[model samples]
Target: MSDATRPRLKVLAAMSGGVDSAVAAARAAEAGHDVTGVHLALSANPKSFRTGARGCCTVEDSHDARRAADVIGIPFYVWDLAERFRRDVVEDFVAEYAAGRTPNPCLRCNEKIKFAALLDKALALGFDAVCTGHYAQVVTRPDGSRELHRAADMAKDQSYVLGVLDDRQLAHAMFPLGDTETTKEEIRAEAAARGLFVAKKPDSHDICFIADGDTQGFLAKHLGTAEGDIVDEAGAKLGTHSGAYGFTIGQRKGLRLGNPAGDGTPRYVLDISPVENTVTVGPAASLDIHALTAINPRWCGTTPAAPGPYTAQLRAHGSETPVTARLDGGELHVAFDQPVRGVAPGQAVVLYDGTRVVGSATIATTQRSTPGPSGA
Candidate 1:
């Protein structure tokens, strides 16, 4: 939309102290929107400086965001959401692991914190939309309904993590970086041209909350240590582990198994049972899962009433697999055209129709066929 035709909106841009958000906020302002920058203080005790680019939410990041807002000539502020982050993302991560399921903290944060909590507060304050640096597009149909789609930059597409956003959230969401075909280097160049100091900053990686990037160690601290038995499908003990929650599906390394398979092939983590306090290890071929049942469905638009052909993404940043899925009787049933391995409970399974995000749900259970004499 052109500046003359587009309505000037009271935009609340979420500056994450990175080059992308700085550039995104600048773009929103240059588009003639009444933009104000806000950085989320997700950590209560924020670190003074980040260790390389491994994590974010440090005291130095807040300063970068402030300087960017100054260069953009927009008012800036920091919102302390530490308590909410702990209760929603961090605690949920620990609880999911304790229940013997792998969870995606980024997806949870997008669902509960960014869209739910932060968006709610923004709307309550009379903001027209919440703008972010997420590389996902929001398309509005002629019927006045909104849809979320993948970004033009496929390499940086974040639609999988954002699949949890419902129609309501999509209505008030703005992603300034989504429609761009520019590369990351181009984005940094844009930031530099705009006089943003974060132009050359490294993109944050790993779990932002985990400073050391040691997920198992963080979980052990929260869930505590407990010796558990590692067994086979037939309940034959193979080894022992400090905690069953530490291992996830398709995990091979760090298993520390004392015995190898009968055929001498390496074993993979097949299942985790918190109830039994047991971790199941089996052949790698057995990890292939044909079907899955998921709950807590969140759709971008209308809910599908019948089964449809689409693609299923089992993890963020993972490849999509062609599948047949249906939302029936308050649950999602997905049958993969090709069996996918490493799927675990508590992970979000996002469905897509081509580039458009159909919806997402939490994987509750999966059905796997055993490899028989044919080894199929």
Candidate 2:
């Protein structure tokens, strides 16, 4: 947010009943904003989501958030966004897998649900900014343009998932926890000091909608089971599987192949063909990708005018790899300095300039051959 904005602006804090978000709402209220806490009810069947104390996006989580809001002296409300989440994130997840690709539901939630749906409503309700616990900084340049950057705590930085946020979103976004150099331990301590009940709550690591963390089973239930052939790069049938959507690129376990490779080396899933209902397995080296094409580019600040040097992160928790990328013909093309493994279609490719997030796109295709440093 720009410095020119008023100090006591109306701020909507998204409280997920997590320690980080509780602290974030408290911090925002302390900062003198007219902060109001809100918990997003993302599932129609709340019981179908994770229900234990450690679970998120559930009835228990909403209770925790309401109690935290009372302690923070903010009005609390629950917004039922179950239909939107089902359409944008859940359905998209199933369709991506059905199309022989892997999708990150967490990242998609941040994009379609958190920023798009939530932020839009907040703006319509006269809120000056929407605040969250995401560990990413919004830096305002001299020209007053906002840029999204990594947090001081590298280990907990979430800029990769927030890469889907565009420049407009950055303008009205407030991350109370991002600028701090404090670790997770410090944050928890702060929450406890502030009398937040979620201080010691275990962090949720599973997909909120998939309560059991059984992704294969979830996909099978949604996409249905179909007997398919498991094949190799040479079009030779290696085995058969219940469904092609059950597997993921670069998967190395539960292949259930009839026999091991000729060299007795474990093979990895190199490709999935939904049309052919087949999964291709090969040596690990076959999973290395040198370049890829991405679609639906969303820039955090400004779109790059030309190809340039930058670093790319393929997964939310993945390390940044040196890359050269550019946008052309409505697609983002990126070339890695060294081949990286396990990059899959339907996953986002977030580009960064140093600690600042440039933008992100949905990966569509991967190539084993390099496309030159400029991705020409």
Candidate 3:
């Protein structure tokens, strides 16, 4: 479509009071589109705590976003999304941990809160698209389907976390930072040049709802601690754990096992059985898995053909490995081309075709495949 024939789009930019989001709003306004800035208040009561210049959804963050919006000559608003964020992201994170799974709150926030809920609200308000500072791209294929691709900056690429977005959501999404071959420093420089207040602010990490980086502490405080038994793979009692939620697959430290292995080698957590109130330990090699099962799979577009080999990453920063994936019933079965270590349940398995994200699903279980005899 020619620029003259195209609609004069109204874009809603989700500003997080960061340099990246500030630059994103600026870029959107410079693109000749009517732009508005929105800051989602995800915390239950943001006014209770003094806002910091570096945190997300803080009172100071709202102020920073408002300043950016003013500089960009766009209207600004703060939407109270605390209730939805609690139910969709925070509560789900706690529930997943209570069930002995390590959940990614960022992914859940993007899937349920930002892209799904916020996108719906923007569309209802007559906005043509919603933009964010996420470092991922939306490309239109020859078939007119929108494909999610990695950002130009590999270190800041966020495609894995955004793999849950479906095609329709991608169609109405904008990522101005995706095409920029600039680093965080450069973005901050641009913001500083524009005299934006958040130019020098540090990035926020960890679960946003959790005050500190204490996942176990947060779980214990909310869910209450459940003492459990730590045992060997054969179900023989080896030690006692403070809580099952505190442990994860392949964790070798903090076991506090009173007994050592027969070979005097340190053992690792191979599995956690919540029903049995036990954490199984064995040789570290036992953490290797050749195959895994995942449920609630969501593809970027339609489901791809089964029995196709693709690249899969177990975690956001994890290395991508070739795998053969197939849909079985309602679950996804994936067999790695090579053995992978520490394949934990509850982590996301993101599938990709080169730089394009295909889909992602939560890992349900992992199993070790029997090896062939030597010299076969």
Candidate 4:
């Protein structure tokens, strides 16, 4: 579309002190949007600088974001969302782990903080849309509805984490990087060409709140010590653990089981019972799950015309398995075409039809086929 025909928008670009966001903000300005950059102060007591690529939300990160805004010649401001982040993301993470369930905080941030909280405020304050550097595409359908699709760069696609967004939230979301069929290297180069300070900044990885990647230690500090017995499926005691919440399904490491499996096979964590304070360990075959039930389903667009085939992803960066899904009694029941391993409860199971995100839900439970005499 030419500039004469293009509609000018009052855009709020969420800058995360990364090259991607810097370039995104630049692109928004280049497109003639009345863009303003905002950096989210998620960490209350941020360190002086980021340690490696483990975390963002540091003092230096905010400075970098500000410098990027200056390079882009846009108005910049920092929004303090530390308390909200603690309540919504950090505390929720601990609570989920305490309940013997795995939770993805990035997904929660997108659901609660970014789209729900930030977007609501942005729209109310007269902004037409909330732009970000998330690697996901939003397509405006011919019927004037918006559809969320995978990024052109498959390696950097982030639609899985963004599956939490509903159609209404997606309507006012802009992702400049999603439209380009380029890589992260090109984004940084663009930032360099634009004279942005974060051109050489490393991409942030790991959880933002957890400065060190010690999830077990972080949980131990918050939930405290709840001593539990680790046992096999037949209730045979294998060892003991500091807490049942410290382990996840299909985990084989850190169990410290004194005895090896009777048949000399590797043992993995099969289940975690917080109420009983027990962690169940079994052979690898026990991890194969055939069906899973997801609760509190949220569709990005609409419910399927009929129950049929769709690709379901259990984890971010996990394999997509073809499954037949149906919504019954407010729950999404998915039967995988093939047995999938490491299906964890409390994780978001996103459903996709081709590139478009159909819906998502929290995995409440999984059903596995019985192990046979010869194993799974």
Candidate 5:
């Protein structure tokens, strides 16, 4: 197709009734592409006042998205994805906690619900691509491969949560906010200037499906109470915990220990044993790890011929540390360049090569090579 005659892309903007998504739809429409606004209904039991206009799946949000679509002169629709979201993201989150792992629900929602399920549905409906407000960029390399990169706004970079998307998804995706130099405040101001309904909306913080940020309470309510013993590294009973699902790696507070160590130091949760219904506490040093194993890996762009050295990020805003990552029997093994702390299993480990996202996996286990100090 010639440059001018190239078919105008039919894009579906996943609006969440937020300033970011609102501006994204505006920008897409201004670019002359055929645009549609879609608000995903991922919550079935909505009780919050901010449901539609504030959270990801409120009726107010649907109306706001529809308003944005009308303002941009595009067709708008709401897709009920609650069943899939609950099954793939929420249930998996509970299961991960029950297994003593810390799950990143946002990453799960992006991988399973948004990109995988929503993308399929959009494509089946004849949309050329699915666009969103994700603060990430897709670049076409000289070799003609699509590469995922960090957005210009470092503080708002969302590549970590998007690291699991493969090339097929990347091919049919648009991130309109990727190149925008606007901050959240600026976006909100722009929305106000445009008289948008979500101009004064507060940002969503807690998990959308969960009523509150009480993760432990939510897990207990869903998975049933499994009270367990809180022990030290040597398997000495320190105290009793309410449940194994309540604790995560590197957590320091809420142990409820009546006494301190002999050195007057604090203890941290180092491991959780779901099988034994126990949580292991030790000095902060025990949280240090030099290597980790990850299962169910997904490589964006293209898979490396052989895994070598790369920088791995353990958290969304966490520092990128040097590590040697290799694919072993469909799994990923990452050996840190140095001992790193707070290497929690169940969190995402995203790998990168400079600005390009290499791939990512969920941390399954860690192997520590050095013993930590005593009574630390």
Candidate 6:
């Protein structure tokens, strides 16, 4: 489209000092948007440099982001959102672990910080939309309603973490990376061609707050320790542990069992009871779940016209399993056609109709179809 015909927007490009964000910001500018790059300072005390791909939000990252903005010829600024991130993401993660639940901090960051806090601030500053490098598409329908869809590169699609964004947020969101048909390698190549400094920067994989990638140590430092027991299906004590919050469902390692089962079968953690301070272990069969309940559901679009079939995803990169979902009151109930394993509470359960994200909620509890053996 010509500049005369294309819609010009005052856009805020959220630069994460990564190659993807740099390329995305460049694309936004090329598309005729009056883009301004803003790197978010999420860490209270950021390190001077980043060590490998351990975490994000270091001072070095901010430098890279600023340089990218310079190359793109857009005004750059650093927004200090450390306090908000600590309150919303870090505190929530610690509390969820303390309650014997596994929470995904990335989803919370998108929901509360990036789209909510940052977007709100951007609008107040006269920006029409907050553009990011996330690999997810926002499509405008014929009726002018926006829908969030998976990126062209399925392997790199980030729609799961963005499932919490409601319709309102979707209206003011722009994903330049999602509009591309290329892969991360190609994006990095484009950045290098454009003389961006972050062209070869490593991708960050660990949680931002847990810099050392030691979730257990982080939680132990924040929430302290509570002695707990490792028991079998029959409540027969197999071992002891220092904390119940340290363990998660479907975990097989770090159990430190004093004695192996009589049948000599491998054991996996099936449940974690914070109140009882116990970790329940059993055979792999016990991990099979037929139904699950999720709390605090957030739908991206309007409520489903009717309860029906929808693919449910448990993890960000995990396979989408066929299931039926029904929302009651404020909770979501999902029934799987086949048994699903390794589902943990406090994890976000995202529902999708094909590649388009419908909504998501936090897993509260799961139900089994048939009870396993008493001592299994």
* TM-scores of the models, in the order given: 0.96, 0.96, 0.93, 0.96, 0.93, 0.96
Whole-model lDDT values for every prediction: 0.88, 0.88, 0.83, 0.87, 0.82, 0.88
Off by over 4 Å in 6: 1-6, 48-50, 372-376
Across 1-376, the per-residue lDDT of candidate 6 in tens digits comes to 2111237899999999988888889998998999999999998798922567877889989999999999999999999999999899999999999888999999999999999999999999999989899999888776777788888788889999999999999988888888567977898899999999999999988787787888898888998888888898888888898889899989999999978888999999988888899999998888999999999998888877678999988998898999999988888999999999999889999999988899999998888765743321
Worst 10 residues of 4 by lDDT: 1-10
Sum up the clashes in candidate 1: 0
Error of 1 at 338 (Å): 0.9
Model 3: per-residue Cα lDDT at residue 276: 66
Tell me how candidate 3 scores on lDDT.
0.83
Residue 243 in model 1: shift from native, Å? Answer: 0.5
User: For model 3, how does the per-residue alpha-carbon lDDT over 282-311 read when each residue is reduced to its tens digit?
Assistant: 887777788989999998987887679899
Once fitted onto the true fold, the runs of candidate 4 whose alpha carbons sit more than 4 angstroms away are 1-6, 371-376
Mark the 10 consecutive residues where model 6 has the least summed lDDT: 1-10
lDDT of 2 by residue, 34-124 (tens): 9999999988888778845434788888999999999999999999999999999999999999998889888898889888999999999
* C-alpha lDDT of residue 60 in model 6: 87
**Global lDDT for candidate 6?**
0.88
- 1-376 per-residue lDDT for model 4 (tens digits): 2111237899999998888888888998998999999999987798922668878889888999999999899999999888998899999999999998999999999998999888988999999888899888888866777788988888989999999888899878888888678877888888888898888888888888888888898899999998889988888787888899899998989989888999999999888889889988888888888988889888887766678899998888987899999989889999999988988899999999999899899999888876522221
